[model samples]
Target: VMRANYRKILVPITEEAKKLKIFKGEPLDLNEVSNLNTIVEIRKLIKNNQAKIEYLVENKAKKKQAAIYLLTKTKVEYQEILKGLRKTAKKQQALLDNIVKKYHEYPKFGSKIVSELDVSSSVLRTAVKKGWLVKKEQEIYRDPLKDFESRKQKNQIKLNSEQTHALNSIGKSIQKKEAKTFLLEGITGSGKTEVYLHAISIALEQKRNALMLVPEISLTPQMVKQVKERFGDNVAVLHSGLSEGEKYDEWRRIRRGEAQVVVGARSAIFAPLKNIGLIVIDEEHESSYKQNDTPRYHARDVALLRSKFHKCPVVLGSATPSLASRARAQKGRYELLLLTKRANQKSLPKVDLIDLKTVEFTGAQFDLSIPLVDAIKEKIAKKEQVILLLNRRGFASFMLCRNCGFVLKCPNCDISLTLHKDTQQMQCHYCGHKEPIPRKCPKCQSEKIRFLGTGTQKVQEELEKLLPEAKILRMDVDTTRRKGSYKKILDGFGDHKADILLGTQMIAKGLDFPNVTLVGVINADTALSLPDFNSAEKTFDLLTQVSGRAGRAEKTGRVMIQTYNP
Candidate 1:
């Protein structure tokens, strides 16, 4: 049986029976049921709905067990019991004395008390029998962020004139409970996040909740940290990176109104938050906000709908707003708010373009130019960090037989299979088809093969050879496959354990490293040749956003773009 219901049962029929022209609802002998490829449902199989159904219940966030002790004996009676047991039962006497001294702190977790007093359950039962104490069970909440230490903001950040103006506009909408949308067009390091936080504070002051949506899972850690530092335990995080237990506990907390702020990825739009006063979508132009699968929906559209229901303000913030959003702002459909300067009063990074056609290659591969390599070396000598962007992830974009003019491609997909040197396999990124690296061409027994395109892995190898003394950390889909791997890599980089960080577009935006003083784009023209009509727009947005990553802190920064087209 494939499935069953209270009144019916579903069974799969073999293909042979269908070939034999067996019609639906046609009664078949039990012997004939073994050979068919069809679906059959038997009705009225369970009389009075007496069929037994079983399911597993996932209650990871159930009520916890606690212990509370109260002294039933009076002070004088306790003293008499202790005095009488001092000589006969020294252990009981000591236990009784300790319980008496800490009776006021009765309501504590059972585990806490056990670890603190170093006593067993049998001893506690004996004490209860002697009337020295009373024990009872209580329920407590399971804290998902128990290990996360709340680092409250030591000194409040003073907002600039533009930030104050933007906050004031959002504040007015929140105060009047108006369902309005705002397009916050701010350059990188323009303090848009500060405005969002201040608006959230105002919402909380009005006794309302706030919901924040970030485009990528990579951005969630930093955003959650900032929000947690501001609101402490009042914030709950929801994202696919979290475990099932953590998600369940956080969901329950939000439902119980224990958390006032919700921060997560795209799916966070459906978070069970009530009385929302504001919704903020950071990097609003990112395509990651659109669900590609069935039940397709965009978080931005959903946020607008939710604003209508809650009568709240929705803020769409981005350094480079999408053309659609910009058009809307131009049409006066969305209230436009602009921030013209960096929050730290620093100048933007200086960017230089290098023509790959004329520039000298730094290594055997033509991925990194000499100028970019020299800049990286300079930064390393000064104890500063660098960021390199490569839009691809494998060791090589494709494997080709130079002699036969043939390329290895996935059978399932027509696209070329990328060569991964670490895995010694050619893998198709689209369909996940993998095969061993080839020595001789299958079509012609020629061994003249070459890897033609640059990716993050190949660049990493080249960087290591070029700068053997420098520490490098690579971030890509291949390296960050395990849970919590994102946090580990980011934390390592933030702690200055690596001299250079390299990755694909995932590292292009929403990353802040104060020590990074140089940024390089291996191939700035990768996205310009795409088949989509919006390819140019996407390429421009990416370059602008990534260039902003440098020179964010007090130190000046430099950027280098290498392209053959230019």
Candidate 2:
């Protein structure tokens, strides 16, 4: 005997069952029954009445359909169709006119037309029925890299002896289907990327796929642009910066074996592209490769695992190799390839350290020193560009009251709330908590409030005041919160629209601007002050990578590091 509905039992005439609204000879949904004891008692009565039990089925999520409807204009005469339609049917007429005007010669997206014109599906169906329009349902990928223009012709870059040797060594592994790992330790401006591109081409030539992972989303644009220019539509990019639809579409493309080359940030290591002939992890030393959240996986380790599964070679390229990767090479577990000279045969930028404790500052904030300001002026006068790395965002690090020594902090994380002048809000970086900037100190109600510490926004304000004519572009998490903002900022800087590109750590690496002749590190001690064990290593990596952004072209580059500790 099995449990039965309380109402389904004929002999359920007890006081408790009546209190629960259970009636005899009435089918009751067990879900609506509240009291467990009453339900059990009613089930016992039903079991004595020869009732049987049935188990409920759990619902499963349905698979998402990737196909979408596509609309195109047919050869039917639009004027005749409009003439046949009643003049009162203005919506249908307008949609027909738009389809003829915009999509007469080519296929147009049906959803785009519907949203843009606010036309309903009924109108489209009527038009399709009239034979004035054609509808075809097909799976289409939402291209995230659509903004990047493809190169009409792929220019063959002449690789130097070092680059050629590295490519050849990687090529041998690809040819032999050996799951080998190689440590490509090259200087910042050495043609490591070029070597990666050539090796990707070799893998494609073998009718196999390839994956390239960058450390940051900021770097993805430049790398994607280069790869797209080389491989065109065959390239797919995956990163958090893309919208969910874009990521899903790109993922679908990779899974369907449409994209031959997949480039993205750390999470892209899981792209389902079978027959991977090569895997390249750029900036291998970057700590960003390790995911801090659940299912914490490092991309470098995943790349090695994928290489083993596909029997392909893995390339770990970095200017400053992590100690673990370097040690592995030393232990003969991974082959080490060195590229000492710059790819363009140019000299490394001359790095000068400014003693912030001794040198006079250009502004009251003491963020930019006299030498740095003067060098910036010189570069602006020469019509060159400058990249200023502050490594922090917002206007101020924290708000402090001089009278009461009170500091505003996030309630959730207990971290100082950063003052963002643009939004006029105090925001916590770790937990995303935001509050309006207080007029006075919350603790003491003192009017004597001061914002301390420098950020990219404050330095940008200073730069504008110092170099009035300099066109500045600020790139941080605040400015780049919108979609396609990274490409916009980088493209604007690349086109020489901005003389100074001010940003945080995101701007520190994987950027190549030939016109950028000078790079200024507003404060070099920020990273070194961290209590972490690898803070010093992170500091060195930041300095080395950011310094590489300057003088990449014919002009010699210069870097000034302002550090009070130095």
Candidate 3:
């Protein structure tokens, strides 16, 4: 399973070689010699019978060589940390609370948090003196959920009959301590998340941990909140948005068994959690679960492996299961549980597709059709909101010189640089290379350069022009680049602060806002044009997910999908 093997060449100092000052080899740590080329050379020598170096698989903590070390509160140090509890100054107490929170969050390293706590060194010094916190020279785990406020104990929610049945099936596997795979296929708004939460409760009740994998960045915060709210501070979240310190602490929490529940993105499947009672891959159909890089491994596949190793239950839950998983469930390899109806008994939204070839354009922009504009205006008039998904960001997909027909492209990558109006730069979506937007073509020096191809930013601009009174909140990679921007934008829309919410694919899934009565897909053909075989499946999933976000409350939802191909 190892991708590369590194070995250190060590030779005892010999009088002849030492006196000559030409030693053949020196004592070195194995980790310090991580060169693949050196390993290949040694392998060749061994194959030729020219060398007889022994291979040793050293079993140690995976992160012992890491730069930061964890400082944990000793068992008897709890009271010491809380010394002079009431008499402590308000500011000092707050800083102390922060330190205590970190202690509970994970084995927080002494070096990372002390300087940043906005407290004097004496506070940390006092804790050390009282044996309240001990600095140990060991690698620490990164915790992304470190900043999450610790919550009070929450009561377990009651499950409906369907959720009970699913939990019962999962519970049986946990009770038997046998490896089993389950496919929990449910429609949108079917309370699949409820089933997952209850199953996790069962796993923890049995004194075993659980690992849950979400699909994308959009799902992480929403799901993490739910899991954390249910499991309290014992839950660790792993995702890409987390800073290095946060990730390290969360990882260490799982590794050391400090965290009982793990909720994260695709890479969370590899968390060093032992004796896991349950593994869940939420939104199992998402392509994001499949790693696109080397040592490529699907989260589903890894879940199955860990389930087998730990003799636990692995649940794959999705409104639309992938074809491969559905086939497996069909063949009885995985036990399938179905939730066909909405948990709230609300009717599904009405879906209407606008054919661009036949529909009349609303304005000179030629992007938002007349019917879509009218729908948005109607929603705004009713005090409801709208979500517009363009599946593309930036002001335009490319810049073209009208005179010479020269197109602007990224020098480092083959893809064209997207014109970002907000940043006033031509940015490469793939490589992140950016330069000032060009007025004249770099190649032909043509003055008439045109921004071609519509994007979320362009659609947002058009919406503002068409509906001048509508308040719009744009959520995309460009708009929500900051750490907490996703939640901020979603919260604003939910609070009726924004009448129109527009964005790329990130806004398409796992968003629930009842006031969002109308969902307009400015262009639905983006994913369909991909060369991938499952492009249709992806497009279908996206449209279905985004459409589901409309009118989830008492109001009936309406979706208008604008497509060129019908």
Q: Which candidate is the best by lDDT?
A: 2
Estimate, for each residue in 1-566, the C-alpha lDDT of model 2 and write its tens digit.
Answer: 01232332233344454444455445455566679886686678666653443445432322233323345435356656767888899889888677567654346667776787898878877777876667776555666887898777788899999999999999999999999999999998998999999999999999999999999999999999999988888999999998766777787789999899999999899998999999999999999999999999999998999999999999999999998999999999999999999999999999999998898877778788889999999999999999999888999999999998999999999999999999989999998999999999999899999999978889999888988999999999999999989999999999999999999999999899999999999999988888999999899999999999999989999999999887
- lDDT, model 1, position 466: 97
Better of 1 and 3 by TM-score: 1
Candidate 1: tens digits of C-alpha lDDT, residues 1-566: 11222222222254433334443544333333454343232222223242222333334444556786666866677677777775766557666677568656654555665667677766678877876667888756555445456675455999999999999999999999999999999999899999999999999999999999998887777778788889988999888887665776787788999999999999889999999999999999998999999879999999999999999999999999999999999999999999999999999899999999998997799899899999999999999999999888999998788888999999998999999999999999998999999989878979898888979999999999999999999999999888777877888999999999999888888899999899999999999997989988888888898899898999998999989887
Give me the displacement of residue 163 in model 3, in angstroms: 2.5
TM-scores, all models, native as reference: 0.85, 0.82, 0.77
Q: Could you give me the TM-score of model 1 versus the true structure?
A: 0.85
> In model 2, which runs have C-alpha deviations exceeding 4 angstroms?
1-127, 130-134
Clashing pairs in 1: 13-36, 13-37, 13-38, 14-36, 14-37, 15-36, 15-37
Name the top TM-score candidate.
1
**Candidate 1, residue 351: CA error in Å?**
0.7
What candidate 3 gets wrong by more than 4 Å, as runs, is 1-143, 146-157
Q: Write down the worst ten-residue block by lDDT for model 3.
A: 14-23
Segments in model 1 whose C-alpha atoms lie over 4 Å from true places: 1-98, 117-148
